[model samples]
Target chain A: MDEVSRKTFLLFGDSLTQRSFDEGGWGGRLASAYQRKADVIARGYSGYNTRWAAYTLEKIFTKGHVPPDLVTIFFGANDAALPDRLNGRQHVPIEEYVAHLRAFVEHIRSVGTKHIILITPPPVDETVRVQENQQKVGGEQEAAMLPERTNAVAGEYAKAVKQLGEELGIPVVDLWSNIQMQPLWQACLSDGLHFTSTGNAAVYHLVQAKINEALPHLRPDALSMDFPGHADIDASSPDSAFKGTAIS
Target chain B: MDEVSRKTFLLFGDSLTQRSFDEGGWGGRLASAYQRKADVIARGYSGYNTRWAAYTLEKIFTKGHVPPDLVTIFFGANDAALPDRLNGRQHVPIEEYVAHLRAFVEHIRSVGTKHIILITPPPVDETVRVQENQQKVGGEQEAAMLPERTNAVAGEYAKAVKQLGEELGIPVVDLWSNIQMQPLWQACLSDGLHFTSTGNAAVYHLVQAKINEALPHLRPDALSMDFPGHADIDASSPDSAFKGTAIS
Candidate 1:
């Protein structure tokens, strides 16, 4: 590919995509690793669920400064995390959550960008609170979610998502199993839910490897472009367009 | 004002605008009585201070599904309600609140639609906790705040706002004194901050009167639109946006 015509890789995820702690986030690392070839746009919002992500996707695609050559979708960590609805102490269900994720996927697909890679949630931590009331809803889906088992939830979600991606004819990077297998993945997690920068880096490198395998003709790391975490991403700068304020 | 063309009055605020209870929120009543016609776009996000309002303004503007010809800005009931940050328990300071309010103003200005109207928050209820902590940084900002002490905070916020409106060449509708004189306004407020529907009605009418006085020519009521509550708005219209896969 021509130096200036390299692909643009956009990362859309939750906290793992945004944490800049130990270093820049996973998206940041992906940018650095593929600095020369791909322009990595990080569209990560901490604590946002699939519903909010679906709502925001429209704005990101339509009003964002520069359109991307490819967009990678990831969420659900927060969708599963429902704060007790104010006063009611009610939680939005996971079934309702899957619907929201589906909507987010549809919204992204509607943008008509052929290149989209759906990534399932990273993994859940084994919390006693998460374990106490864990009930199997039945079938492979229900059977997959065991008490205090994050691996199961990740697996079920990925299975459901694989159906979605295959239906839409888009690729999916199954971060569920990919993350579970990483030797240092568990160690780098900030909580059962979040990740430290190192954890994010692991995910980023994994993504880089996947993208390289999928699009070998277009190696992201070999192209020439700006560093991911350059100090000067101002609101007025073109680079800040994707990272800055709401289009809506 | 012509009967058909009298300016439509729109009420936008917190519980103050909703009229917390029986007060029949200002906008609802204004719609019934105003000759020129007035519609209340009751954007009542209860327990929200300026931060939430700042977050909401742009969304309301961009939605454009149903826009008010004249929009009223009413807050501080909750902004004042925030306890002080230091003791991790003090009232949110007047200056700190002013900044949040300023951000709201900035976002509103950015939208550039709907004529702007500023409504001073209603006086706080006369409560003991608020009275004892009147001088305390965040005490007066919370709902249980008393009228006399909350007045000082309202006065400070109002003064800054008055100056801002004057400087910006916008309209100002002072609710402080008007609310004090009204037997209805105080009666409807549950806490110092939130209003019953009647109180909302009173404020809505007050805003209606001011907007009518300012533009005697436009009738927003005729053009009024409804703000459906968050998708889970009610039992009838469940959020279909995210349909769960629990079809079995």
Candidate 2:
């Protein structure tokens, strides 16, 4: 009984991660790119910060479970929430965020995962965020509420992520800096924080580039197809094609 | 340690199935629809007919491997190939196609999968197929090669699938008939056989409708969110939020 198991690429993070399968999302792009090579799994939890996510680690990567071949640890957007703001419930202090991220790497490694990539949170557009929030509130009170997240604060978290990645010798996708490199970076985000289609494309390209650079062997082109190609199978003796070592 | 295992929806079939993760593909749509509820796994083999797929049943659903909660068995397009044509290598007789489908149902059942949906091949456009084949072959000889598959032949395979589904008491997504009911059904397919964006949208809607009618319990709304919503968490004691039955 030969078992067929494709390589798994797990995405673990918050709403940004959870919504990665939306139309034209980075996760969907990855799934399309790695279609025949790997199974891209989304364990994204909307509105989750590292503190809350900490409890899910044990449950998500259970003991003796076959660890994912690759994992992208994307967080920090929600963690950068202002501690005094309306969305402060989702915030974790900078120090705690760094510590939680480090712990995540260690825990994932301990569970036998071989490849890990860290993605920093993108910059938040305060003006857009304020307007979006106002639309949600739909009243004069909307003006009373301040933007719960700021670009500068999110940048700090992004820097923290880059530093941690350097310390752990893991590749990092500095989403904040990358998206800003584009013209009219504000348009990259749908709301003040979440990604727009352009932002998703940027993430997809960066992730693909990082994979090619740091984990070349895991690239879709580098992996063997699970079965023989139709052209390779003999019409009269199709079963013969499956007899070879190709069906991995 | 609590283990977090989401329900799995496995898609098994040939090229049509394999390409379902494309930009506007049905598989991608389903992945989006079932975002946090279930993992949609695509075990799609391009250019595979039922005869060849029979060899993969054991490898894909091995002993002791947890069976997918829901399975979509979609095939027949390649199986309907005219045996004397260029694509004849993929042809399987109608009798064999039905027998193989029944075997697939039995094998899936033996593995403990509870929900199964069968999708017949969509209608083929012979004119477009011939032109597409000509573009591939090039030159004046393109005119010499007849379309490898005909709508009537594929329809036979589709009918076989419907019959098999009926005998097994499984629901069927009659794609052949459904697509034709749409305006300019030819536009639904990209290259006569494969799905266009419109066709993919059609598949996505039909599959969703089928799930609602035949397997309502598997609907995204019916499933519990794996983690608690952020609004439900206590700002003062975030840890308390994870203590309930919500962390399934």
Candidate 3:
């Protein structure tokens, strides 16, 4: 009945998090880096905002389950949608969004999660978003239609996340500004929202650096492999090499 | 203490399995396909053979833990190593390899695993392996050393795996023969042993096809999302959308 108790790193959020397993995605990169050391679990609900996330918080982080060692809470892109636009149904009032973020942290803490990282939504590309929406609607006639989301509005939500992280004393990856630091940052976004390979790489590097600074013990290199390396095994009597080893 | 229960798919094997989270790896592709439907857990131990895996089976699938819904047991690459070569420490006799494979299935079933898939050792390219080893040793004098593994030897182990699968009434992905079916299959391998992106894609497609044929209900499209999709939510009263949702 002995358990293989590798540490777990959970990613909780919306489509951004859901798509993190795509080729060259941040989540996949993290999983590769932590191979044999920990488990990276993805709990992403696409098209969800902080308000919707609030309703499923307890369900996803149920009390008795083994708590994740580290978690990244990434949200807010959908919450920043313009209230009167076509996608307004996905928007949450700025105040409620901030409150929901706080509640999520409190709930996760109550469930015994040890480390948490808050990632602000990456910068949006308004021009690209508008063009993409126009294409989706299928006509040049809709060219004049207003964009449902704007870079400025997303920036506001990203700022709230940063301020909350400071107030709560939690580490925050300021994705909003960090991504913009890259030359030609707009190219980082594929459809003005989600990431391109470059953007994913940027997020991976940022998160990795944050882990190195805030949770050095969780780094893959710093952790021991679940089992001994093959070179360390006793060739003549392999069982002896694993006889007293703790599976974890 | 309610738990968020998601179906689990476990991948157990050696280095090929260990590196399955790399960009374009079959494991990562599977995870992406099953996002929000199941948790794809990787328990890959590099340079491991059947004998080594036997010692950790119980520890990995402990009695009280929730059994994975599906498990893929992949091995034999290291087991096919020539006994008198530089990597002889990893070799397991063909008879013992087959016995160990059967034991793996029994041990997993004892712990309540529902579905099992076996992936045979992939074909080896002796010329490539020998040249690579020579480069590693950094000397022209080592060029005459025999390869630590041969395609013919690997094929025998693969055949044993297939025969074992039939005897146990389990589905098997005969990677050795399957990869050989590709046009210029040697290009599919990066190092004579490990896979290239093309090889990973091939593995992903083959396993996916097997899932469709034998475990249709476990396919990503056939399963329910852990939570309701955004469009299904009641925007006016968001909580209503999740009021009776099971969150699994």
Candidate 3: pairs in clash? none
Q: Candidate 1 regions off by >4 Å?
A: A1-7, A20-24, A63-66, A81-99, A128-151, A221-248, B1-248
Best DockQ among the predictions, by candidate number: 3
Residue B156 displacement in candidate 1 (angstroms): 51
Candidate 1, B1-248: lDDT as tens digits: 01112233344455454432122334434433432123223444444455444444554555423344666777765555435322222234667666766666665555554577887766766564354455555554653253433556666666776777787777787777777788655675654556654566566577767766775654444342221213333323234432422111
**Candidate 2: segments with Cα more than 4 A from true spot:** A142-145, A244-248, B142-145, B244-248
Candidate 3: what lDDT? 0.87
Error of 3 at B53 (Å): 1.5
**What would the per-residue lDDT of candidate 3 be over residues A1-248, giving only the tens digit for each residue?**
13776888999999999999988889999999999888888988899998788778888888877788898999999999988875888888889889989989988998999899999999989888888778877546444377888888889999999999999989999999999999999988999999998999999999999999988998778988888788888878776788753221
**DockQ, model 2, C-alpha based:** 0.47
Worst 10 residues of 2 chain B by lDDT: B239-248
Question: How does model 2 score by TM-score?
Answer: 0.95
State which docking tier applies to candidate 3: medium
- Taking all chains together, each candidate's TM-score versus the true structure is 0.39, 0.95, 0.96
User: What does the lDDT come to for candidate 1?
Assistant: 0.53
Best prediction by TM-score: 3
* Docking class for candidate 2: acceptable
What's the lDDT for candidate 2? 0.86
Task: Give the docking tier of candidate 1.
Answer: incorrect
Candidate 1 displacement at residue A175 in angstroms: 1.9
Instruction: Give me the TM-scores for chain A across all models, comma-separated.
Output: 0.67, 0.94, 0.94
